[model samples]
Target chain A: AQTVTQSQPEMSVQEAETVTLSCTYDTSENNYYLFWYKQPPSRQMILVIRQEAYKQQNATENRFSVNFQKAAKSFSLKISDSQLGDTAMYFCAFNVGSSNTGKLIFGQGTTLQVKP
Target chain B: GAGVSQSPSNKVTEKGKDVELRCDPISGHTALYWYRQSLGQGLEFLIYFQGNSAPDKSGLPSDRFSAERTGGSVSTLTIQRTQQEDSAVYLCASSLRGLYSYNEQFFGPGTRLTVL
Candidate 1:
């Protein structure tokens, strides 16, 4: 079984600053996918960024990027130029690559607050 | 459909009562999944349907919880004799089939179940 872990229960960042949320996972699967999702008070899970385990380069989506260390089994999300809108619960998720099933496991979310 | 959608955005039921939650996957998606998000915990995998076959159901917490997909589209998760511990947000997601595809699961606005 694969499990994801988020060490920080909550994080805060000043407006226009950067914040990094830590996540680690235990999985034997060689090939998999890592994802970061944001859930606003509206309770909608929004995709932030994703990284493929096979890719050596990290994934970057404008303001959101990930530091994926496959050997260490670590995948972290970095949010730059944080704005008030970035305040939400952030979750780190994982999934088996190309498996017949669509099972995405998530970590205990980190509530992020962007203070102005 | 525009996106994955779950019915009855919020459900409040008494203990020992039966509750049914519905999910409508996006049109053309061949894979659907169900997950439970506890108050402060991560999202737990429940079950999934891939073109009508669910090869893996090991994630289901108990036999009292069952889910089924019909016509490879809509799905329903039923909890017989719900317990207070069953209070959580039920999330549904849909994705395209095949191992080579991007395999990103689009989530729906979860149904919040509060067992009293």
Candidate 2:
């Protein structure tokens, strides 16, 4: 069984500042994928970024990037130059690459608030 | 190209009643998934469908919960005898491929279900 954990229940950052949301997972599978998703008040779940466990290089998408520590089983999201639009509920997810079923195991979301 | 879409953005139903949530994945996506977001449980995988293979129902909470994907494009999640605990946002996502493929899953604006 695999599990994802987001220790921070809530986070706040000022506009133009940087913020990092921490995430950790417990999985025995060597081949897997980790992801970060954002859910706004509109209830839309948006994919922020993703990282492949086999790849040593971390994943980056514009202002959003991930610090993936495979050995530590930690995948944290870094949001640079945060904006009000960044306010949302962020989730960390995990999926096994070898499994036929692509079901994702998600962490308890961390609510982010960007203050102007 | 249009992203995943869900119908009945908001649904209000009474306890013991039945409700159906629909999801339309991307045209070429071969994998679709259903997830539930609630206060008690942040985000949990409910079901998964990939191409013509057997759907994975392992994540379903109980027998009252069931889902079906027709023609490998549209999916409907049926919740029978809904309870207050079933009040949550139902999210759907789709990806290009399944199994070994690490395609990013695009999500839809979830259907928020409120049980009164």
Index of the highest-lDDT prediction:
2
Instruction: Write candidate 1's Cα lDDT for B1-116 as tens digits.
Output: 49889999999999999999999998998888888999999889888788856436777899999998888889999999999999999998888873433577888999999999
Residues A1-116 of candidate 2: C-alpha lDDT, one tens digit per residue: 68899999999999999999999999999999998989898878888998989999999999999999998999999999999999999999998998887678899999999999
lDDT of 1 by residue, A1-116 (tens): 68999999999999999999999999998988899999998888888998889999999999999999999999999999999999999999988776657478899999999999
Could you tell me which residue pairs clash in candidate 2?
none
Our model 2 lands, by Cα RMSD against the true structure, at 1.3
lDDT of predicted model 2: 0.91
DockQ value of candidate 2: 0.70
Quote model 2's iRMS: 1.6
Q: What lDDT does each candidate get?
A: 0.89, 0.91
